[model samples]
Target chain A: MSLAAFLTPESHSTCRPVGASVLGQRLESPADIADITRRVWQDSMNVLQAPHIYSGVEMALWDLLGKRYEEPVYRLLGYDKAFAKQPYVVVPFAAVPEQTFERMRHIRQAGYRAVKTGWSGFGHGNIASDLSQLAAAREGLGADARLFIDAARIWGCDVVAAKRYCPLFDQFSIEWVEEPFDPTALNAYADFAAHHGRMRLAAGENIHSIQQAQQLLNIAGIGVIQIDCGRVGGIGAAKEIAQYADLRCARYINHTYTSHLALSASLQAYAGLERQDLCEYPMDPTSLSWSICREHLLVGGDGEVTIPNAPGLGITISLDDLQRYVVDLEIRIGRTTLYRTPSIR
Target chain B: MSLAAFLTPESHSTCRPVGASVLGQRLESPADIADITRRVWQDSMNVLQAPHIYSGVEMALWDLLGKRYEEPVYRLLGYDKAFAKQPYVVVPFAAVPEQTFERMRHIRQAGYRAVKTGWSGFGHGNIASDLSQLAAAREGLGADARLFIDAARIWGCDVVAAKRYCPLFDQFSIEWVEEPFDPTALNAYADFAAHHGRMRLAAGENIHSIQQAQQLLNIAGIGVIQIDCGRVGGIGAAKEIAQYADLRCARYINHTYTSHLALSASLQAYAGLERQDLCEYPMDPTSLSWSICREHLLVGGDGEVTIPNAPGLGITISLDDLQRYVVDLEIRIGRTTLYRTPSIR
Candidate 1:
């Protein structure tokens, strides 16, 4: 079953934290964000598969806190000014070189300075064409723009193939490879880094906490640490990781593939970084960045979007938007809306 | 606010493990259980806090697997007969000596050979009276029977008071002191264990994983390891911990203070242990054990319980019992039910 289905709007209130000390206070402190999210984390940790639901709640918290402090969420995280807000467009891979080139061209034309493409047909068949497609995209984006490739890690790329193709893409000036292999394969990463000096490896989205981030950043090859606030507990955890990542000299990037709500949180978190690199933006036209709170997340002619300076994550939800976009239907099994045996204690 | 409230019967299906490979297969192998619980553990590791709800689902899994194999759940874990089925009655402390003696007398008369009392009046005012009460409990149980003291660690006992009184109880042949200090205070436990040679320090239920269990068991002072199936992920995780505890030469006991559903799982797991020790049984009349599934969980005249040999945890739930015991009213909210805006992704 989909997690999105169970994280119903009605259920959000049940997961919200309760404490008298913070009851009347503003949600500005990183501790406040952690306190709120950790409650939900502890309550749902054994049941929820991916923290996707908690991720949404964490985004809401950042928005609330940003609004409460009359600053963007990132500024609450100690950003004196907006950090580098230039994001790389995460473009899905195409089967052919023309489709890949077309996507890269669209990204460049859209004023995006960088583009990341997925490995659509990497190992299925015709490895040469896939490498050619990467070359075509790099050539299309031109030498001035940045290019990154995502292996999706779960697909299990062959070490031999990664060795062969990494250098091939390095010739195309691919800045770094995102999850070129499994993140859990630490030895594989060390081996890859030892062999492929030309291509840097980046990963952090799957790393769950400050501890996990520290461990991953310490790995020899991973140069970029991509942190998702939701996955790492909350904004506080992400900021702590960002600080740790900077101390270790790793480039910090925020992973926001969800709605503008989460993107706002990511942007805020990235603002707290000492050495901010590039954050991920889902450039897919179908993404909620365009349809839900589209105006705030829009890109400018300078190949970067400004951080929303409005209170909270700088976005507001209207009931009309909820009515138009959200699917609301009562899901009932018999007469019981909430079905479970009452607690004995 | 209670986990049992959230882990309703309807939601059990959502958290239960799935996958075609283990769908029809019997759950006999430790590896199979590890695979199943690990999937849930990984899914909920960062988001969900305490795994209490997931622990219930784990119990259900053990029950299902037990039934499928036509062997007692313990037998599936490699046991021939019931593991030390005799349990210690977790007797709450009474303010007066008569109350303590009377309770211990009832425990002995009821065929329970072992009794554990709480550290109620120990640190509060008079330490002598509390020691006298424990001595009274000892005299009431007649010396051959086992006696344990639960400090309830969360109550925050003073170190000076514990140091003063632990030796006094030891003089009365108190078998072990349960959580004399904080579960997290490894140094305190080690120091106490070094000084107090009379009573062994016991702990386990609060621990959440095999790693934590290993760390706690390695402490020089702790002598008994209490494994709670729910607190430690599930039966597989608890079993792994039990094996580790045995290797360390610590006595193994199952911690079950909840419903009979969880107790059966704990008992089954305890049956797999090589050094089977006395398990905990809440003898309070108000407990769900009396009202929920009273007959299935009844202790025999020998103060021992036989593992449910029936398919799946051996105990079956009746809708009539649920109707009588469960709360059926909807928990009302002052505001709109669906407060949070829907997710954009």
Candidate 2:
């Protein structure tokens, strides 16, 4: 679902928030957005899993609001200035230990001081394989660099299974272990956090509401709250969580894996928080993700990136790329066309 | 989304669980259900809000499983026998106090011992109107009958607003005040539960997962835990919560306002718990809802309802009604057809 919120066509300040999931209901006009969002909130039993449609619509609304006010989204969100963040190169674990080492080495060579390797059978394999991968990642990053391991919820609720890798994580000096258990497995998270040595639990990328994030911080004992703006009901919700995390004395970070547009939206939430400096940057994005924005927030000499100072989300959406990648779609109920993809002007 | 799960077409035990929300993705075969459910869990930030699709799918799977085993769903769920539940007539508040009185009187005359009036501007109006309605309902039902007030979440975290009617609730001997605040407003629920009078807090119909139901029982201080199997990831999740509620000594009830098919599915969760007897029976269902099931679970002279002893959900789906109501739906991407409404044979 690609939503462009605008006051008028002549204003020419269209805001696009591309939602990956399709909405269950049809929106006749912009007036329906709030009502639909409220219905979604009231009807959905789990706000965290059902907030994608509302999230995208909310992001677009914020973008439009920013453009109307002629200020950056961060400024509109009450931040006087956007803070610079240390960009961590995010990649998946390679097929083998040597490949994982090479990937980490390449990231280090590319001036990224922090790197995260996740998914791709990381925790699913044998203990020896995991140890080799961890050893390779640490050796390749060369000691001083920050290394984050994302287990991607491989262990579910099994504390014993997750604890097996804790010694290896401690040996590798991992900054944090991300999503070792399911998000709703509060007991498991708390238990794991209590037993783990040195490494802190980091999660909340899947959080859609403020309450879930607070639960993770308060009950799950996570040291880091990673929020994705596009997934967490847009910037407003993410900002709320960031503020809550600050109140609870926890680190807040943005989780971005898609376009630079998403990256900017994610950053605007906690862009003013200088202390929570790390930002997850997609180092090897798919072509579709890369095509969404014309200009990217590139890493600088200091190995840090800042959100654009210009108005709205401060990134221009590439119409040409969107058109090239656009799939012509239509949804028909009986004889009536409920939805048809609008032509890119 | 209507799903029919079966091991084989020749088995003649097609189980249908009609989902209120459309699925975001297309399922190629039965094998995709588990994978899609997992994706929905992982990708959705709010599982409670996003589990509708999975819930319906899950119900269908359980129905099929029960049919294969030649036993009632409750028995398959590990219950030795299904217990009879006290049926309560569920209706919206009338337009005026007199109408409310008449409605309650009518329900009483029809032999229902318990009645619940909710929504339709119940708590939205001034305190005087609420009191008048409450008085009228109580007087019409007489002194012996149980009265449940469904606030329909009109207060929205306003403890003061909800508290204004507490004295009236106690005076009328109201059994429970349902959803006085927003489902996610844990603080408000806890606050209101702490200060409220005789009427206990009842909630959990909006719960989509076991964790959420448990949270309400353990943290929110709700005495009555209502589970809608059609919404809370099907019978499995509802049964889990019922057991959890039993362990915590919370009153477990079904929140059904749809077809008899849904009512049966809802009943199956807590059908084994004899002590938790109240079952919500839709007294004012829409025509479409009424037409969905061939056989209805009518309240007996004993003022109680029981699940069918037959295999599966027991109630036969009205194919004629489904065909009559089925809207022709088609989704197309480019030249390829992703989905079209399956013909009801």
Highest DockQ scorer: 2
Q: What TM-score applies to chain A of candidate 1?
A: 0.82
Per-residue lDDT tens digits for candidate 1, residues A1-345, read: 223223322323222332311235456576766665545543343333325445555667677766666877777777788755678877767778887788788778868888888666554446677778877798678889988877656334356667777666668877777776544455466567677752377777765546446656664357787888766666667778777777777788888766666676777776755467567876555643445663457777666767777787887654444445543323223355532322222
Per-residue C-alpha lDDT of model 1 across residues B224-308, encoded as one tens digit per residue = 8888787676776777777777776778888876567777788777675645756777655575455566345668776686667
lDDT of 2 at A263: 88
Model 2, span A152-198: residue lDDT tens: 88887889999988888889998889999887777788888898831
- A-chain TM-score in candidate 2? 0.87
Q: Lowest summed lDDT over 10 consecutive residues: which window, candidate 1 chain A?
A: A13-22
Task: Give per-model CA RMSD.
Answer: 8.9, 6.8
